[model samples]
Target: MEQRTHRSEVMLSESFMYDGVIIALIISVANNLYDLGVLDLANEFILILIIWYGIIEHFIRNSNVINFDIRYRLLFYTTLLGGAALNTIVYKTYGISYIPIIIAPMIITLLVDYEFGASAGLILSLSTAFHHHDFFMFLHLFPQVFISTYLLKNTKNRIQVAKAGLISGIVSLVMILLQEPVRHFYFSMRDYIVIFLNPIFSSIAVVGILPYIEITTRIYSNIGLAEIATINHPLLKTLSLHAPGTYQHSLRVAELAEHAAESIGANSVLVRACALYHDIGKIRNPEFFVENLKSPEENPHNTLPPDVSKNIIMKHVTDGIEIARKNRLPIQIELAIPQ
Candidate 1:
């Protein structure tokens, strides 16, 4: 009940903020469009893209959490503007070069969701396409974006994130492939340097910011990461203390799930997170599991039929989620528990 109230309050407070941001950004776009002269379709599209991205970002993705914390707000807005800014920089400085702007979106996609990242990428690309006054190149940008980002999903480690430079590089290559057979867009080797290498190097360097963000914010980013080390979290120590067997089970599950995710190209962070919570229900009945008790204690379920025992066992998933929610765990962590 307390948990549900907290959820309701958070929702009510954020409801206005999210609606307000969208409404404000829409007006801002209209104002900017009118001031810039409503003659050009390209400019009109950029305004539309901004609003669309704003709506999707704040209303859909971010509507879940409604706090006024500066760190995360900065994360959201920076990612929004950053994508557009990068695209503009790449296109203006080096013609037809999109790698510069895509650098941020690739990482943002991994840390966040493909939907948000995709919106960011589109807004940035379309912003550049319109701003540069090239409708053809602008409209044709989606192919590379789709192929590149899709392949990069399920990245859950530093090495992979650091290696996202590879993603951008591959995107550039895909863009090149899409442009096939006699499109001499860049002037020379130096221009190609910006076109090809900027995204690769930028992606690698840009991911470094994530750790700094994590450190300063102490937020998990829904990527299954947190600033809390082993000693910092109680559940880990409790698992080590009174529930060693459950601890071992969790470890095994984490290991297996992680491997399965890696093998099948699933989000390894999400899989590992689920493994951590898979047995949280057991915390309510630690001794019921064989390892916790020296003498087989009387099964409390002896008082009830198998159906009742099953209900009790199944209730832990909801119980664990409640505890997690009370602690303000990320939705990703909450998702780790069974439905």
Candidate 2:
């Protein structure tokens, strides 16, 4: 109970810190816009405060949609802010058509989920449109954002990401042409190419940088999950060699959990990955575990008191967490070790 209380306090402190960081980022961005002469300090600043309030309220109301974990929240908000900053810089330097509007949505979709991706895309589009005072920017960006997110659902490979980007680029090109029909026809060929290829190049850039993001954030995308879920992973290979029975059990559990997750419309790949690593702690004391014991007489628990055996069994949870951290496993997989 005391531990739980301490944890709660820590979480509350983290929440306060997260809130401070978010507000600071928002103010910084607003001040930057003000300096750029894009925002009128009188009315637009008030409007931004209102928008920030709405965003906080939305997050509070849908806490499950946006994870409470500090890392996840920081990543989500930072990605949005970064996207907005990039958009602003690119818009000033290369014009609105050259803004990589799909970057935030695509990266969030691949790293988190469709819901988060879509939400980020909406917020980004709304904010960008307001900044530029152009409703057409929202119309132009929102559709491609949605398209890129939808196309990249359950993405398993780099090729799929590139493909989604290509499709989004095509959609963006169509929206651009439709937005100003007569003006677009008068556009130079280079202008058309820039507008169409912006999303594609942005996506390719995401593909190149995704591994680094995953490494820095410790949040694995489906692509990363897929790679770690394979049997050839170092930890799995070690588990197979040291605790064959537990390794086999993990395989069976992974299969069942994956099927169950799919039936419930959950992330089966994540489920499978978690299930595979759930029993990894047994590798430390393979002989103590029933699955790894060669015979009934080989049960080490037989020589220990009930309380001692129970403690030993429960120790696996902490041990697993230590191993997971040492291996730099995804937090989801580490969390599943206890359950």
* Best-matching candidate per lDDT: 2
User: What tens-digit string does per-residue lDDT give for candidate 1 at 166-255?
Assistant: 655666655655664555554466654555676667666656666665544434543335232233467666665766788787878778
TM-score (C-alpha) between model 2 and the true structure: 0.87
Looking at candidate 2, what is the lDDT of residue 124? 68
Least well predicted 10-residue stretch by lDDT in candidate 1: 222-231
TM-score of each: 0.58, 0.87
Note the Cα lDDT for every prediction shown: 0.58, 0.80
Superposed on all Cα atoms, model 2 deviates from the true structure by an RMSD in Å of: 3.7
lDDT of 2 by residue, 1-339 (tens): 999989976786577556645644563474356355533433444554465555543553366534635677678777877887787778777887788888988888888777778766776676677666778878889898999999889988889999989998899889878988644446688988988999999999989888888888778888899889999999999999999999999999999999999999888998999999998988898888988888999898999999999988998889899999999998778877887
Residue 101 alpha-carbon offset, candidate 2, angstroms: 1.4
